[model samples]
Target: MSEQRVASPRTFPTAGEAAFREKVRGLRRWGRWGEDDQRGAVNLVTPEKVREAAGLVRLGLPVSLSRAFPVAPAANNPNPAEHYLRRRVRGEHGEGSVTDYAGVNCHGKATTHLDALCHVWNHDGMWNGRDAAEVVTGDGVTFGGIEQFADGITTRGVLLDVPAFRGASFVEWERQVTGEELDAVARAAGVEVRPGDALVIHSGREAWDRAHPRPWGAPDPDGVYRLPGLHASCLDYFHDSDCGVVVWDMMDAVPNEYGVPHCTHAAIFALGLPLLDNALIEPLAQVCRRESRTDFMLTVAPLPIAGGTGSPVNPIAIL
Candidate 1:
């Protein structure tokens, strides 16, 4: 047997690209907000939506939807975070305090981060069709920067717990979730993932990682990177539901059948939706199950890093 060739992260096969572009064309929101808009679908998060979401906090409980900062290397974290400590030590009586500096390369599988509209792009361009070469400058992004979300993304959030919905402990790497499964999860949970809301999908990626204890995102002996996550078809559901952000434990399944790159991540530009990736949702899942409800007030404030492609984020789900 021979090692399989992986698709270039930036390119797709002829037929695959054609199929993907066509699928995305129908869901595109190029001019829905305005020709000059940079905020994308988050524009749907009106004041009224925030207030309504706030009203759902009956228990006054908040669950963190973020994974702990990856400070040490692990099977999934190859480039661990950078942390430096400075001690003000005249501390004979422990009077002095300690300060630390931290830096992260947060866009990969390990870090819990928020991907801005400019994080990804291709021949179709970025959010609102701005050319990547033009917007993504040498120093920083000129358009659709993470700073555009300075006020934060606060809206109603509902979890679609696939493990609970499918009666499984975790999803298999070979499996891919479709739009129909999402809809079914919503129905089963008795929740409505309305427009301008955060749609959290708990795919049990963290749990799977713990159970398997292997280096995910790294190619296996067969040279294929495989993971369990949503398929491109889920984009149709997103468009139809008009979701503002997609909060997920897992992202696009690796070695996607699409034969295209950024299988589901294309939504960042295609539908102008932000993606909250690598969220740790098992705790949130446990709470939702215990409470018998899934809807909550989801809030996340990205670091005000102007022109950044994305930001390491800690989102909270208030129930």
Candidate 2:
């Protein structure tokens, strides 16, 4: 059996220590930090040595993980309409008038959306410590409001490109990606799963949609949309890491035919890790391929819609 490798505990500098470093650098700066400071203090150390020291200081907890789910007006439109509503009017003074409106059904299973804290409530009637009633309104509500995540999510991201690792461009329809498959993909990627890192799995499911289009909100003939995703063991990996979040390119891990609540969802949610479902990961794949690298600066900012179960996100990556 393969040994289960665990991540070591990590430490980071306190705010005060960071401030002190900034102060010292400012004193030596000829207007900007690190300018004159580098000339004087850095002269004693080579650039590579300085870089090594800076790297140590810069090391923090981990990267944030999140993704933007692409949205369209209709669930299964062959030419899915963008979320733009337009109204036209005829007037004597004006040739024509048009009003644009846009609304999305992000809550639907197929839509790309973040599961708000309220989206799930334990049978015990509490969410992250607050009473479900207190956080939820008469209509239904919860905390860690969508607005709370607007500033942006900060955590580590680990990508397990299942399709690429499998030597297949895409996963076949209705095919369930197993935990073993996920581990194999991680191994192929040369990444050691770590806790606190957002696990992103790309099964090429999104691309499959182009060739095998299905109703947006409806499941495929197999009773579930087939997509590659983390297996049960991957969930254990997340649990061990104490990960703050999990995002995926597929709608969910289990097929609809199974008819039972998704095990992956139940397991992760039980641990309080928020799920970002229906994520767009093709771009991330492109970036990784172009650079021959998997790590990069990933930013995800969800819409600040108070009382909403979930919201659309515009996520970007800076390599």
Candidate 3:
């Protein structure tokens, strides 16, 4: 089926510096957990929360929410992951050993990865106001890196299927999912966004994939087309709900009304929140539709890359 694209004009709210600052201050979680806190909003996932999430796995059905990484660079992936055989031990050295090394630029439109707290920064600093010069050095991020999530992440997953809420197969690229729409969808789906929930917003990635067929990686693609994604205002909803982690299939819309770009990242940084970008959630959406449920147990464990800004993750949803 052909995909629907939004073409209507709309303006993004809270674009001015004063308003943006207030927004940031209103939702910021800095010092909430303590100065030395590294988990950011993820600290909301307490043992009791994990117990509650476990109870949601009645069917014991686990679905992966990661996109397949491409071997060669595509039109959208300028820096595709590199995997090569590093060593092979044979003879008396060992019974048989084959080792492979992989290198990836986790933050992009192609790979499914987790953006650590240090991934985004503004004039102020990184999460908890850590000076960028001190935290992010030539070596990499010394603080708020992916190592903070080394223990792994597990929480209740809430699927906000905007397409379903809009009664469409896929929302058009020009269309942006607003915070009000997020709340409406949650109410419609009979689910509620609770504190520490891993909020996964599905903004027509399935529909776009079906229409485009090929993966995004073409040069000058931005001039060619835009992908459907959440509006910057969704951060406001996230703040109110106390979302621990925000996951999206396509990220955010481009050329928004807000003069400041990457407001999504800015809001996250202010709130000391982590983000999971470019997730594959079509199968999970289908399962949710069939079961008439939008909440499940989610697990995401990123590589323990010390001093790394982010890490590729294969998030799983267990129903």
Off by over 4 Å in 3: 1-22, 86-97, 213-225
What is the alpha-carbon lDDT for the whole of candidate 1? 0.84
lDDT of 2 by residue, 1-319 (tens): 0011111112211233233233322222132223112111112223443233234222232222233323443433223324565666678766776676566665544455666655653333223334566777865464545554555554445677877886777666446566677667777778666544556777776567675656323444644333334433454555445445666776444332223334355432244455677677877786677667654444456777766766766554454
lDDT of 1 by residue, 19-138 (tens): 778778778989998998989999999999999999999999989988888898975676889999998867478678789999998588788999988898767888898998778777
**TM-score for each prediction?**
0.93, 0.63, 0.88
Which candidate model has the greater lDDT, 1 or 3? 1
Could you tell me the C-alpha RMSD of candidate 3 in Å? 4.6
In angstroms, how far off is 35's CA in candidate 2? 47
Ten-residue stretch with the least lDDT total in model 3:
1-10
Candidate ranking under lDDT, highest first, comes to 1, 3, 2
Say which candidate scores most in TM-score.
1
- Model 3 CA lDDT for position 97: 68
Model 1 poorest ten-residue lDDT run: 1-10
Candidate with top lDDT is: 1
